[model samples]
Target: MPTSASVRPALNHLQQLDGIRFIAVGMVLFDHWMVGRIELPLGALGVTIFFVLSGFLITRILLSSKDKLSNQPNGGIGKYLKTFYIRRTLRIFPIYYLTLFILYLVNEPPVRRTIGWLALYATNLYMARHVSWMGTVDHLWSLAVEEQVYLFFPLLLFFVPRRWVPLTAGLMIIGSVALRYVLYQARMPWFIGYVTMPACLDSFGLGAIMAFWWLYERERFGNVFSRTRWLWISIALFIIVTTLTKVLPAIPDSRGWAGHHNIMSDVWERLAASFIGFFLIGRAVIGFKGPMKWILENPVSQYMGRISYGLYLFHNFVFNVFHTQPTHFTVRAWRRLSEMMPFLNSSYFFQFSFYLALTVALATISWFLIEKPVNNLKDRFSY
Candidate 1:
């Protein structure tokens, strides 16, 4: 909540850290493509990666500030909630609304239909209804999952002790994994994925734990993470291997290491993915730089990260705008993109390009009109 001419994160929000956001969005783009056409069969795991990073990063921030936050009278729950929501609003609402506003003006019937759910943060439910319309603005489910967790998390901390954070996070992981296992067994559609929060809670919980380690457990982890590089290498290996091959498909698509496609296996993979996310994020923040950082934190890429919410919310609608055509090229034309962009060869590449371009346009427009202005509203909560 502290705002100044040079507002900084409690633990140096590194120059390239923003790049992970791009990674998450990119994975989503590819995953959607894979779902549309099963050429690669190894795409949606990007989202799992995203969830992992989310858990790690959010945890880092909270744990670092735990002491100061704890010292506050009554755990400072009131101020913390106010500031948190204010920042979230600045970050999430503006661009989201603008896209809806524009769509409403155009009377884009399909997008307009989903607006009600988005307004209520019931996007997961809406996506539930349109399970097959993966191209619809269904990705918003993750955002809903994250925000819904944020809504209750601080209260949890206020009521619970700092020492219990890790234990709580671990429980969340168990719950999330179990939930996901059940869903997998039921053969549920991906659209309602976030509804299975028990399977996802560990990601956020892991993040909270990381925040604790970075802050209070600094001494224990300082020499460990601040100096570790092998951790980063291993995670990078996992990211690449999982993306290119089916090394980690047990959770993303399959069931487990034993090749048994059961709920138990799915649970195991979910936990594994969460652990990987925790390490990757902690390693990066502590100075584990790699080749991807260069492009990940680039000015444009960072901006995309910033306006990513808008892009995620609107890209599907932008994509579906051209659904009138049964032809792939016709869909591309609706977005004003030329399918002849020589680089788009494979299903992954083609889907990546289309989703990328659509997100970029959405980001650019949303940043200038909605995101930036909405951020200004933070001045109101500066108290």
Candidate 2:
């Protein structure tokens, strides 16, 4: 009944999933503002959303493809990895590296050959070693984390047995849990996970696990995501709890190393946030039910949903260049500043709103002209 040619349940459900993308991307934007005036906000939770979404989407893609054929098709993993890397490159590079060029004019020269590292998708590693040089668009790190996961996931699917999908997925979760404890034992600085592979997996793996769970057990998800009252309340509670962790200072024992003292609790909070992301994703995939559903699945926001990838990539660039100097208010000084304009200066809120409006415009252009063309071009290659 099954053949190697068919796509495993084509990702037609992505439209339903679009709502979550808007939320996750919005989280990143909101969280960055925290970096300016606030102590903590759950905005970084957006990264968690991105990771979970990554796991869900990628796993689904692989599963769908595998459903149609064997794991070793298209000249085995050599070809698999090659084409996979190319797709990732095409999806991320053009606009991302272009941002770097724009930065050269406003900021510093990050790479003489920015094209090389981006083409290779090793920009994350480059950023890791040269942290200062990298975050020209600071948000690119999350994209790097997602790319790193992509690098490993296919190889994992290829070698790991079909029945062991759950096993491998569990192993990743367990490994992340265990790794955090070890980092705690080692007296790491922050409780929050960063660009490291272990921390990143929670979000990505959560998404992947959701995908697998959905594909093989649709009725189960149908029942869970369908429940409007109890589950929505639960999603809210999970959000509140996770939000506290990022902002509220943990009551560390004043006696010894805070990292080691609260390692278990710290790890718990991180996992808890991941769980929140996982559940909300399920809720989003199931689509709207009551008022919350209407809010989540709004039409205008859905357009934002389609160009979300481009929006996420270019948003900080828009922010950085626009609000490069938000403190100064003098007319002569403001006139000299290229970042500000009369429309953007309408009010403080408008300044922030302008960044959003401009980002959507740039992202829309990049999406159609650059990202879309590159995506179409990727279709020409097959493993």
How many angstroms is residue 138 displaced in model 1 relative to the true structure, after the best TM-score fit? 1.7
The prediction achieving the highest lDDT against the true structure is 2
Give the Cα-based TM-score of candidate 2 against the true structure. Answer: 0.79
**All models: lDDT?**
0.60, 0.65
Quality of model 2 by C-alpha lDDT:
0.65
Poorest 10 consecutive residues by lDDT, candidate 2? 253-262
Q: Looking at model 1, report the run of 10 residues with the lowest lDDT sum.
A: 254-263
lDDT for 187 (candidate 2)? 51
- lDDT by residue (269-311, candidate 1, tens digit) is 4455555666666666665446655777678778767766666
Best by TM-score: 2
| lDDT of candidate 2 over 64-153, digit per residue (tens) | 655544545452556656666787788777777786666555544344445456545566656545433343344566676776787678
TM-score of each: 0.75, 0.79
